[model samples]
Target: MRTTRSSTSRSACLPSLLLRGGLTAVGAAAVVGMAAAPALAAGSTTVGPAGDYFSASLSNSATLTVGSVTVTCSVSQSAPSQPLGTNSANQVPTANSNPAGPVTSTINAPTFTNCRTNMPLVNAQVTTSGTWGISAQHGSPSTVSFQIPQGGLEVQTSGLASCHAVTAPDGPASVAGDWTNGNPASTLVFAGDTVPVEVTGGFGCPTAATQGSFSATYQVRNVSTPSSPINITA
Candidate 1:
Protein backbone atom coordinates (compact mmCIF):
# COMPACT_ATOMS: atom_id res chain seq x y z
CA MET A 1 0.00 0.00 0.00
CA ARG A 2 1.17 3.50 -0.81
CA THR A 3 0.19 6.88 0.57
CA THR A 4 -0.38 9.88 -1.64
CA ARG A 5 1.11 13.31 -0.99
CA SER A 6 -1.10 16.30 -0.19
CA SER A 7 -1.35 18.82 -2.98
CA THR A 8 -2.08 21.73 -0.61
CA SER A 9 0.66 24.36 -0.49
CA ARG A 10 1.15 27.69 1.32
CA SER A 11 2.50 30.87 -0.19
CA ALA A 12 6.20 31.59 0.50
CA CYS A 13 5.33 35.16 1.60
CA LEU A 14 3.22 33.77 4.48
CA PRO A 15 6.36 32.76 6.44
CA SER A 16 7.88 36.26 5.97
CA LEU A 17 4.60 37.81 7.06
CA LEU A 18 4.58 35.78 10.29
CA LEU A 19 8.21 36.64 11.07
CA ARG A 20 7.60 40.35 10.62
CA GLY A 21 4.94 40.40 13.36
CA GLY A 22 7.41 39.41 16.13
CA LEU A 23 6.13 35.83 15.59
CA THR A 24 8.59 33.15 14.51
CA ALA A 25 8.23 31.51 11.07
CA VAL A 26 8.98 28.08 12.62
CA GLY A 27 5.30 27.38 13.37
CA ALA A 28 4.22 28.35 9.83
CA ALA A 29 6.98 26.27 8.21
CA ALA A 30 6.09 23.33 10.40
CA VAL A 31 2.48 23.48 9.24
CA VAL A 32 3.53 23.63 5.58
CA GLY A 33 5.99 20.74 5.99
CA MET A 34 3.42 18.52 7.67
CA ALA A 35 0.91 19.15 4.90
CA ALA A 36 3.45 18.38 2.19
CA ALA A 37 4.71 15.16 3.77
CA PRO A 38 3.52 11.93 2.16
CA ALA A 39 1.18 9.80 4.20
CA LEU A 40 3.23 6.64 3.61
CA ALA A 41 6.73 5.79 2.48
CA ALA A 42 7.27 4.59 -1.10
CA GLY A 43 9.09 1.36 -1.86
CA SER A 44 8.77 -1.98 -3.69
CA THR A 45 8.00 -5.06 -1.55
CA THR A 46 9.05 -8.56 -2.64
CA VAL A 47 9.58 -12.02 -1.16
CA GLY A 48 11.37 -15.17 -2.33
CA PRO A 49 14.00 -17.73 -1.34
CA ALA A 50 16.85 -16.07 0.52
CA GLY A 51 19.20 -18.99 0.01
CA ASP A 52 19.57 -22.27 -1.89
CA TYR A 53 17.58 -24.43 0.53
CA PHE A 54 14.00 -23.43 1.49
CA SER A 55 11.51 -25.12 3.87
CA ALA A 56 8.29 -24.09 5.59
CA SER A 57 5.14 -25.34 7.35
CA LEU A 58 1.48 -24.26 7.06
CA SER A 59 -1.26 -24.57 9.68
CA ASN A 60 -5.00 -24.20 9.03
CA SER A 61 -8.15 -24.06 11.09
CA ALA A 62 -11.81 -23.40 10.35
CA THR A 63 -15.35 -24.14 11.48
CA LEU A 64 -18.00 -25.75 9.29
CA THR A 65 -21.71 -25.31 9.81
CA VAL A 66 -23.80 -28.04 8.20
CA GLY A 67 -27.51 -27.66 8.67
CA SER A 68 -27.71 -27.18 12.46
CA VAL A 69 -24.41 -28.83 13.26
CA THR A 70 -21.15 -26.90 13.51
CA VAL A 71 -17.81 -28.67 13.34
CA THR A 72 -14.35 -27.19 13.75
CA CYS A 73 -11.46 -28.39 11.61
CA SER A 74 -7.71 -27.97 12.12
CA VAL A 75 -4.86 -29.09 9.88
CA SER A 76 -1.04 -28.84 9.97
CA GLN A 77 1.24 -29.43 7.02
CA SER A 78 5.00 -29.72 6.54
CA ALA A 79 6.61 -29.04 3.16
CA PRO A 80 9.75 -30.81 2.13
CA SER A 81 12.81 -28.61 1.92
CA GLN A 82 13.48 -27.70 -1.70
CA PRO A 83 16.75 -26.76 -3.36
CA LEU A 84 16.72 -23.58 -5.40
CA GLY A 85 19.71 -24.78 -7.34
CA THR A 86 22.60 -27.23 -7.15
CA ASN A 87 24.87 -24.53 -5.78
CA SER A 88 25.34 -20.76 -5.45
CA ALA A 89 26.78 -20.66 -8.97
CA ASN A 90 23.29 -21.30 -10.39
CA GLN A 91 21.12 -20.55 -7.36
CA VAL A 92 19.97 -17.17 -8.64
CA PRO A 93 16.35 -16.56 -7.62
CA THR A 94 13.91 -15.36 -10.22
CA ALA A 95 10.80 -13.20 -9.92
CA ASN A 96 7.48 -15.07 -10.37
CA SER A 97 9.03 -18.52 -10.78
CA ASN A 98 8.27 -21.96 -9.39
CA PRO A 99 10.58 -23.86 -7.12
CA ALA A 100 13.42 -25.87 -8.66
CA GLY A 101 11.50 -29.11 -8.08
CA PRO A 102 8.00 -30.26 -7.20
CA VAL A 103 7.59 -29.53 -3.49
CA THR A 104 5.65 -32.25 -1.64
CA SER A 105 3.85 -31.54 1.61
CA THR A 106 2.59 -33.98 4.26
CA ILE A 107 -0.53 -33.29 6.20
CA ASN A 108 -0.30 -34.07 9.89
CA ALA A 109 -3.02 -35.64 12.00
CA PRO A 110 -6.14 -33.49 11.59
CA THR A 111 -8.71 -33.06 14.34
CA PHE A 112 -12.36 -31.99 14.29
CA THR A 113 -14.52 -30.57 17.04
CA ASN A 114 -18.00 -31.97 17.81
CA CYS A 115 -17.92 -34.18 14.76
CA ARG A 116 -18.97 -37.51 16.22
CA THR A 117 -22.15 -36.30 17.88
CA ASN A 118 -23.21 -33.76 15.26
CA MET A 119 -22.40 -35.53 12.04
CA PRO A 120 -22.52 -39.09 10.69
CA LEU A 121 -18.75 -39.14 10.28
CA VAL A 122 -16.85 -40.86 13.05
CA ASN A 123 -13.32 -39.60 12.27
CA ALA A 124 -11.60 -37.82 9.39
CA GLN A 125 -8.03 -37.76 8.17
CA VAL A 126 -6.50 -35.86 5.28
CA THR A 127 -4.22 -37.48 2.77
CA THR A 128 -0.52 -37.41 3.60
CA SER A 129 0.58 -36.05 0.19
CA GLY A 130 0.11 -32.59 -1.34
CA THR A 131 1.98 -30.12 -3.56
CA TRP A 132 2.94 -26.43 -3.17
CA GLY A 133 4.56 -23.64 -5.18
CA ILE A 134 6.02 -20.20 -4.62
CA SER A 135 5.58 -17.22 -6.97
CA ALA A 136 8.17 -14.51 -6.32
CA GLN A 137 7.59 -10.85 -7.07
CA HIS A 138 10.25 -8.19 -7.67
CA GLY A 139 10.48 -5.04 -5.50
CA SER A 140 12.32 -3.44 -2.56
CA PRO A 141 10.39 -5.59 -0.06
CA SER A 142 9.90 -8.62 -2.31
CA THR A 143 6.70 -10.64 -1.92
CA VAL A 144 6.12 -14.36 -2.40
CA SER A 145 2.75 -15.86 -3.25
CA PHE A 146 1.92 -19.34 -2.01
CA GLN A 147 -0.43 -21.81 -3.63
CA ILE A 148 -1.57 -25.43 -3.37
CA PRO A 149 -2.29 -26.90 -6.78
CA GLN A 150 -5.69 -28.20 -7.73
CA GLY A 151 -6.65 -31.73 -6.63
CA GLY A 152 -4.19 -31.40 -3.77
CA LEU A 153 -6.75 -31.55 -0.98
CA GLU A 154 -7.18 -35.32 -0.65
CA VAL A 155 -9.24 -36.50 2.31
CA GLN A 156 -10.17 -39.85 3.89
CA THR A 157 -12.93 -40.45 6.36
CA SER A 158 -14.11 -43.33 8.55
CA GLY A 159 -17.63 -43.76 9.80
CA LEU A 160 -20.36 -46.44 9.96
CA ALA A 161 -19.65 -49.76 8.31
CA SER A 162 -21.29 -48.53 5.12
CA CYS A 163 -19.24 -45.34 4.99
CA HIS A 164 -16.07 -45.24 2.88
CA ALA A 165 -13.23 -42.82 2.18
CA VAL A 166 -13.69 -40.17 -0.51
CA THR A 167 -11.35 -37.76 -2.28
CA ALA A 168 -12.03 -34.15 -3.26
CA PRO A 169 -11.50 -33.14 -6.87
CA ASP A 170 -8.50 -31.01 -7.80
CA GLY A 171 -8.97 -27.23 -7.62
CA PRO A 172 -6.66 -24.25 -7.19
CA ALA A 173 -6.24 -23.07 -3.59
CA SER A 174 -4.06 -20.19 -2.41
CA VAL A 175 -3.07 -18.13 0.59
CA ALA A 176 -5.21 -15.10 1.29
CA GLY A 177 -2.26 -12.69 1.48
CA ASP A 178 1.27 -12.37 0.22
CA TRP A 179 4.37 -12.92 2.35
CA THR A 180 6.82 -10.05 2.26
CA ASN A 181 10.55 -10.35 2.85
CA GLY A 182 12.33 -8.82 5.90
CA ASN A 183 9.46 -9.51 8.26
CA PRO A 184 10.36 -9.77 11.95
CA ALA A 185 9.16 -13.36 12.17
CA SER A 186 10.17 -16.07 9.72
CA THR A 187 6.65 -17.54 9.73
CA LEU A 188 4.03 -16.20 7.35
CA VAL A 189 0.35 -16.29 8.18
CA PHE A 190 -2.56 -16.69 5.78
CA ALA A 191 -6.19 -15.84 6.26
CA GLY A 192 -8.93 -18.52 6.08
CA ASP A 193 -10.93 -19.14 2.93
CA THR A 194 -13.54 -21.57 1.64
CA VAL A 195 -12.58 -24.50 -0.60
CA PRO A 196 -14.97 -26.81 -2.39
CA VAL A 197 -14.23 -30.40 -1.37
CA GLU A 198 -16.01 -33.52 -2.56
CA VAL A 199 -16.54 -36.55 -0.40
CA THR A 200 -17.92 -40.06 -0.95
CA GLY A 201 -19.22 -41.87 2.10
CA GLY A 202 -22.36 -43.13 3.81
CA PHE A 203 -24.82 -40.34 4.65
CA GLY A 204 -27.17 -40.13 7.65
CA CYS A 205 -27.22 -42.61 10.53
CA PRO A 206 -28.76 -46.00 11.42
CA THR A 207 -29.68 -47.02 7.85
CA ALA A 208 -26.53 -45.39 6.49
CA ALA A 209 -26.50 -44.91 2.72
CA THR A 210 -23.47 -46.31 0.89
CA GLN A 211 -21.39 -44.67 -1.85
CA GLY A 212 -23.03 -41.31 -1.31
CA SER A 213 -21.54 -38.21 -2.91
CA PHE A 214 -21.50 -34.76 -1.35
CA SER A 215 -19.86 -31.44 -2.12
CA ALA A 216 -19.05 -28.87 0.52
CA THR A 217 -17.07 -25.61 0.75
CA TYR A 218 -14.76 -26.22 3.64
CA GLN A 219 -12.57 -23.53 5.25
CA VAL A 220 -8.81 -23.95 5.01
CA ARG A 221 -5.63 -22.06 5.91
CA ASN A 222 -1.87 -22.13 5.21
CA VAL A 223 0.76 -20.92 7.70
CA SER A 224 4.40 -21.60 6.80
CA THR A 225 7.80 -19.96 7.15
CA PRO A 226 10.88 -20.60 5.06
CA SER A 227 14.05 -21.85 6.67
CA SER A 228 17.33 -19.98 6.34
CA PRO A 229 19.47 -20.74 3.32
CA ILE A 230 21.89 -23.65 3.53
CA ASN A 231 25.13 -23.83 1.55
CA ILE A 232 25.56 -26.77 -0.86
CA THR A 233 28.37 -28.01 -3.05
CA ALA A 234 27.93 -27.43 -6.73
Candidate 2:
Protein backbone atom coordinates (compact mmCIF):
# COMPACT_ATOMS: atom_id res chain seq x y z
CA MET A 1 0.00 0.00 0.00
CA ARG A 2 2.55 2.60 -1.16
CA THR A 3 2.58 5.48 -3.68
CA THR A 4 4.19 5.91 -7.12
CA ARG A 5 5.81 8.73 -9.12
CA SER A 6 4.63 10.48 -12.29
CA SER A 7 6.32 11.24 -15.60
CA THR A 8 5.20 14.86 -15.74
CA SER A 9 6.92 15.08 -12.35
CA ARG A 10 10.52 16.11 -11.98
CA SER A 11 13.28 13.61 -11.12
CA ALA A 12 14.89 14.50 -7.80
CA CYS A 13 18.46 14.95 -6.50
CA LEU A 14 19.51 15.87 -2.93
CA PRO A 15 22.55 17.65 -1.55
CA SER A 16 22.98 19.10 1.95
CA LEU A 17 25.24 21.57 3.74
CA LEU A 18 25.11 21.14 7.51
CA LEU A 19 26.63 23.61 10.01
CA ARG A 20 26.99 23.72 13.79
CA GLY A 21 27.74 26.67 16.08
CA GLY A 22 29.53 26.57 19.46
CA LEU A 23 30.18 29.30 22.01
CA THR A 24 33.15 30.01 24.32
CA ALA A 25 33.29 32.48 27.22
CA VAL A 26 35.59 35.49 27.20
CA GLY A 27 35.72 38.07 30.03
CA ALA A 28 32.59 40.09 29.25
CA ALA A 29 32.42 40.32 25.45
CA ALA A 30 30.02 38.36 23.22
CA VAL A 31 31.26 36.63 20.09
CA VAL A 32 29.28 35.08 17.21
CA GLY A 33 30.35 33.13 14.17
CA MET A 34 29.25 30.34 11.78
CA ALA A 35 30.36 26.92 12.94
CA ALA A 36 33.38 25.17 11.44
CA ALA A 37 33.61 26.42 7.85
CA PRO A 38 33.16 30.11 7.21
CA ALA A 39 29.74 30.98 5.82
CA LEU A 40 29.74 29.87 2.19
CA ALA A 41 27.39 28.17 -0.25
CA ALA A 42 27.52 24.36 0.00
CA GLY A 43 24.72 22.73 -2.04
CA SER A 44 23.63 22.65 -5.64
CA THR A 45 23.36 26.11 -7.17
CA THR A 46 21.54 24.56 -10.11
CA VAL A 47 20.66 20.89 -10.56
CA GLY A 48 20.92 19.22 -13.91
CA PRO A 49 20.65 15.72 -15.34
CA ALA A 50 23.91 14.21 -14.10
CA GLY A 51 26.05 16.74 -15.97
CA ASP A 52 23.76 19.70 -16.43
CA TYR A 53 22.56 22.85 -14.63
CA PHE A 54 19.79 25.41 -14.96
CA SER A 55 19.96 28.57 -12.83
CA ALA A 56 21.44 29.89 -9.62
CA SER A 57 19.28 29.35 -6.56
CA LEU A 58 20.49 30.80 -3.26
CA SER A 59 19.35 30.11 0.32
CA ASN A 60 18.25 32.88 2.67
CA SER A 61 20.42 34.00 5.60
CA ALA A 62 19.92 36.29 8.61
CA THR A 63 21.65 37.53 11.77
CA LEU A 64 20.96 37.99 15.52
CA THR A 65 22.67 39.78 18.40
CA VAL A 66 23.55 38.95 22.01
CA GLY A 67 25.69 41.91 23.15
CA SER A 68 27.91 43.52 20.47
CA VAL A 69 29.17 41.25 17.66
CA THR A 70 27.11 40.94 14.48
CA VAL A 71 27.59 37.97 12.13
CA THR A 72 26.46 38.28 8.53
CA CYS A 73 25.95 35.40 6.13
CA SER A 74 24.00 34.01 3.14
CA VAL A 75 23.00 30.45 2.20
CA SER A 76 22.44 28.94 -1.25
CA GLN A 77 20.76 25.56 -1.59
CA SER A 78 18.41 23.77 -4.03
CA ALA A 79 16.74 20.38 -4.60
CA PRO A 80 14.92 19.02 -7.63
CA SER A 81 11.14 19.13 -7.82
CA GLN A 82 9.06 15.94 -7.54
CA PRO A 83 6.24 14.64 -9.67
CA LEU A 84 2.64 13.56 -9.05
CA GLY A 85 2.35 10.38 -6.96
CA THR A 86 2.84 7.04 -8.74
CA ASN A 87 0.48 4.29 -9.84
CA SER A 88 0.25 0.96 -8.04
CA ALA A 89 2.96 -1.41 -9.18
CA ASN A 90 2.08 -4.12 -11.80
CA GLN A 91 -0.75 -1.83 -12.90
CA VAL A 92 0.77 -1.43 -16.31
CA PRO A 93 -0.21 0.83 -19.24
CA THR A 94 -0.48 3.52 -16.62
CA ALA A 95 2.44 5.79 -17.45
CA ASN A 96 6.15 6.26 -16.72
CA SER A 97 7.91 7.60 -13.66
CA ASN A 98 11.11 7.06 -11.69
CA PRO A 99 10.86 4.09 -9.37
CA ALA A 100 10.14 5.81 -6.03
CA GLY A 101 12.40 3.97 -3.62
CA PRO A 102 14.04 3.61 -0.22
CA VAL A 103 12.68 6.72 1.50
CA THR A 104 12.80 5.99 5.25
CA SER A 105 11.15 7.51 8.33
CA THR A 106 13.13 9.10 11.14
CA ILE A 107 11.34 6.74 13.49
CA ASN A 108 11.24 2.96 13.06
CA ALA A 109 7.62 2.95 14.17
CA PRO A 110 6.01 5.74 12.15
CA THR A 111 2.41 4.69 12.07
CA PHE A 112 -0.68 5.33 14.23
CA THR A 113 -2.87 2.49 15.48
CA ASN A 114 -6.20 2.10 17.25
CA CYS A 115 -6.56 -1.59 18.10
CA ARG A 116 -4.72 -3.86 20.49
CA THR A 117 -5.87 -6.86 18.54
CA ASN A 118 -8.07 -9.74 19.89
CA MET A 119 -9.30 -7.40 22.66
CA PRO A 120 -12.52 -6.10 21.14
CA LEU A 121 -14.09 -4.69 24.31
CA VAL A 122 -14.60 -0.92 24.01
CA ASN A 123 -13.07 -0.53 20.60
CA ALA A 124 -12.35 -2.31 17.32
CA GLN A 125 -8.98 -2.90 15.68
CA VAL A 126 -8.30 0.25 13.65
CA THR A 127 -5.86 3.06 13.28
CA THR A 128 -6.76 6.73 13.39
CA SER A 129 -4.15 6.98 10.70
CA GLY A 130 -2.18 10.17 10.13
CA THR A 131 0.91 9.64 8.07
CA TRP A 132 3.92 11.91 8.55
CA GLY A 133 4.28 12.15 4.78
CA ILE A 134 7.46 13.58 3.26
CA SER A 135 8.93 14.91 0.00
CA ALA A 136 11.97 17.17 -0.43
CA GLN A 137 10.86 18.07 -3.95
CA HIS A 138 13.12 18.66 -6.93
CA GLY A 139 15.34 21.74 -6.78
CA SER A 140 14.43 21.73 -3.09
CA PRO A 141 16.95 21.14 -0.30
CA SER A 142 14.63 19.30 2.12
CA THR A 143 15.69 21.28 5.26
CA VAL A 144 18.22 24.15 5.46
CA SER A 145 18.78 26.26 8.58
CA PHE A 146 21.32 29.02 9.26
CA GLN A 147 22.62 30.41 12.57
CA ILE A 148 25.32 32.80 13.76
CA PRO A 149 26.56 31.64 17.20
CA GLN A 150 26.41 35.05 18.85
CA GLY A 151 23.84 36.29 16.34
CA GLY A 152 20.42 34.75 15.63
CA LEU A 153 18.97 31.94 13.50
CA GLU A 154 16.99 31.77 10.27
CA VAL A 155 16.00 29.11 7.67
CA GLN A 156 15.74 28.71 3.90
CA THR A 157 14.60 25.37 2.55
CA SER A 158 12.79 23.42 -0.15
CA GLY A 159 12.88 19.93 1.45
CA LEU A 160 14.91 16.94 2.72
CA ALA A 161 16.42 14.01 0.72
CA SER A 162 16.11 10.21 0.63
CA CYS A 163 18.09 7.34 -0.86
CA HIS A 164 16.31 7.43 -4.20
CA ALA A 165 17.84 4.18 -5.48
CA VAL A 166 16.96 2.13 -2.39
CA THR A 167 13.28 1.89 -3.42
CA ALA A 168 11.76 0.61 -0.18
CA PRO A 169 10.14 3.34 2.00
CA ASP A 170 7.78 4.05 -0.90
CA GLY A 171 6.61 0.85 -2.57
CA PRO A 172 6.30 -0.46 -6.15
CA ALA A 173 9.50 1.42 -5.80
CA SER A 174 13.16 1.64 -6.68
CA VAL A 175 15.83 3.11 -4.43
CA ALA A 176 16.91 6.74 -4.70
CA GLY A 177 19.48 6.12 -2.01
CA ASP A 178 20.71 8.91 0.21
CA TRP A 179 19.69 12.16 -1.40
CA THR A 180 20.38 15.02 1.07
CA ASN A 181 17.31 17.26 1.28
CA GLY A 182 14.00 16.03 2.89
CA ASN A 183 15.49 15.67 6.39
CA PRO A 184 15.79 19.23 7.82
CA ALA A 185 17.76 20.41 10.91
CA SER A 186 20.21 23.16 12.03
CA THR A 187 21.73 24.88 15.16
CA LEU A 188 23.96 27.74 16.40
CA VAL A 189 25.91 28.34 19.62
CA PHE A 190 27.36 31.67 20.66
CA ALA A 191 30.93 32.05 22.05
CA GLY A 192 30.02 29.16 24.40
CA ASP A 193 26.55 30.03 25.58
CA THR A 194 25.25 26.70 26.81
CA VAL A 195 22.25 27.85 28.82
CA PRO A 196 19.52 28.95 26.40
CA VAL A 197 19.17 25.49 24.87
CA GLU A 198 18.17 25.48 21.19
CA VAL A 199 17.49 22.54 18.89
CA THR A 200 15.27 21.26 15.99
CA GLY A 201 14.36 18.00 14.24
CA GLY A 202 12.72 16.42 11.18
CA PHE A 203 10.94 13.88 13.38
CA GLY A 204 9.23 12.14 10.47
CA CYS A 205 11.30 11.18 7.44
CA PRO A 206 15.02 11.92 7.74
CA THR A 207 15.29 10.79 4.12
CA ALA A 208 12.62 11.45 1.52
CA ALA A 209 11.75 10.09 -1.92
CA THR A 210 10.13 11.48 -5.06
CA GLN A 211 6.30 11.84 -5.42
CA GLY A 212 5.43 13.47 -2.06
CA SER A 213 4.88 17.18 -1.41
CA PHE A 214 6.90 19.92 0.28
CA SER A 215 5.61 19.08 3.74
CA ALA A 216 8.45 19.77 6.19
CA THR A 217 9.13 22.60 8.66
CA TYR A 218 12.18 24.13 10.45
CA GLN A 219 12.53 25.51 14.05
CA VAL A 220 14.87 27.77 16.08
CA ARG A 221 15.42 28.66 19.75
CA ASN A 222 17.78 31.06 21.60
CA VAL A 223 18.49 29.82 25.12
CA SER A 224 20.23 32.90 26.51
CA THR A 225 22.59 35.28 24.78
CA PRO A 226 25.28 33.03 23.23
CA SER A 227 27.87 33.01 26.00
CA SER A 228 31.15 34.83 25.45
CA PRO A 229 29.96 35.32 21.90
CA ILE A 230 32.84 36.37 19.68
CA ASN A 231 32.54 37.85 16.22
CA ILE A 232 33.61 35.18 13.74
CA THR A 233 32.42 37.21 10.79
CA ALA A 234 30.89 40.65 10.43
Q: Which candidate number would show the highest lDDT if scored against the true structure?
A: 1
TM-score of each: 0.41, 0.16
lDDT of each: 0.25, 0.17
Kindly provide the TM-score of model 1 when superposed on the true structure, using C-alpha atoms.
Answer: 0.41
Badly placed stretches (over 4 Å) of model 1 are 1-45, 58-75, 82-121, 128-130, 136-145, 160-171, 178-184, 205-234
User: At residue 58, what lDDT does model 2 achieve?
Assistant: 21
Report the poorest 10 consecutive residues by lDDT, candidate 1: 22-31
Q: Distance (Å) between predicted and true CA of 196, model 1?
A: 2.2
